[model samples]
Target: MAAVPLSLQVGERKFTTTKATLSKSGFFSALLAGPWEGDLLMDGSYFIDADPDIFDFVLKYLRHGILPLFYDKVKGHDYRLYLAVLEREHILGHFASPFHKISIIRKRIDEYGFILIWEARYFQVESLEKWIHDKTYLKAIKSTHRASEVDRIQDVSRSFSSELDVEYHTSWKTEKIYICPRRIFVHRGNPEACGRQCKQAQGTAEPEYEEELTVKALAIEKETTFNFEICMDDDR
Candidate 1:
């Protein structure tokens, strides 16, 4: 009910933050929603078996909602270590090829940038994931030197069309729970079903009208308010 101070032990390193801040991450929110014997440590801190170095970036995202731009480098931060962490967490998948050439269009992205986006998605940070997608996805595509302007545009459009489920006569749908790059979209009412009753719906679709919405709807059904009052229960 209150802002609980949280100490996280990663390997030999210890990091501290408030439960409210940690709740920004869906992973941490679920982990802290109730008591768990596996995560608790004798030192009154939650033990997270992850690399503390890479987790520093994760904490920054939770505390400040920091979304780094493509190609932007953090001073004193090694990108290679970040990659290693992703590999260890299985965020990079079986191979690094999928991340390097993202999307079915095979658009190449900066490995570091893709890693950051993947990390946000992995943590289930909806806002941050959408921010990175909206702010950087196209820019990265545009800056790619492998393709010509027209080719890049066509490829990008086709790539996004498939990802966002673009349809000729139906309303395009935005993902309610998952976040994907170049996939944030406004959900206009189903044109094919407009002004029609549910029974008279077009094709096999139900006549359902929905308005344009952002990815914020991803967390709309969840309680996000965090009490700022500090909880002093050390035993917790």
Candidate 2:
């Protein structure tokens, strides 16, 4: 007598299967092993395994919630492949990548829950210091403080910004591009801690202050590059 196939239901949908055979082997072994038990459900339908690799890929994504680096090879080392996998796996709400346009990434993140962005340089001590000094002095004058207090605050802000800039530049040279997930819950309460954690997670060192600041500044500059473009064809 032949054995009956295993059956499972996820939400309102049901799946019945006899067994799955694994042909191509790699990180997707467990997902192709059969008769695999349990029904994987997302969005409303019971997810099905048609092509075992794609199915394994989807299952791995559903279970681990991340696209493996191998899949990213499809996009010529770009994040687009990763993005596609995220969409397929329904796990796009967990990453951010700055390499893609911010507006598009933001939209995807808002609608899908997360997006991936390549880490870019995002800070400049001079600009931040200037803002801080102006704000600090303006606050002192409004509070009826003496001119000396205003000057002192300005001096402190300038010095701090300068020191921070130095540290930022030094660090930037030693670090790699940082990648982070877009989901805040992944870090639990401290999104600021993402930088450190990402470096550690990627087996890299925390950048020195100068490098971090330089990268931050660079990111800001890159974002505003379009605004700085001159129109050569403008009517004189």
lDDT of each: 0.45, 0.31
Candidate 2: residue 2 lDDT (0-100): 68
Top of the candidates by lDDT: 1
Q: What residue runs in model 2 are displaced by over 4 Å at the alpha carbon? A: 1-53, 61-67, 71-80, 89-236
Cα distance off (Å), candidate 2, residue 128:
35
Which residue window of length 10 is worst by lDDT in model 1? 217-226
Give the per-residue lDDT of model 1 (tens digit) for 15-118: 98998888876666766777767668998888765556667766775776544332322142344444433333344233333213222122234765543323
Q: After superposition, how far is residue 80 of candidate 2 from its true place, in Å?
A: 4.3
* Number of residue pairs clashing in candidate 2, backbone atoms closer than 3 angstroms, sequence gap of 3 or more or interchain: 29
Clashes counted in candidate 1 amount to 0
Candidate 2 per-residue lDDT, tens place, 108-225, comes to 5564355544221111112222323233222221111112222122233333221122111112333333334433345533446677556565465443322222222211111101
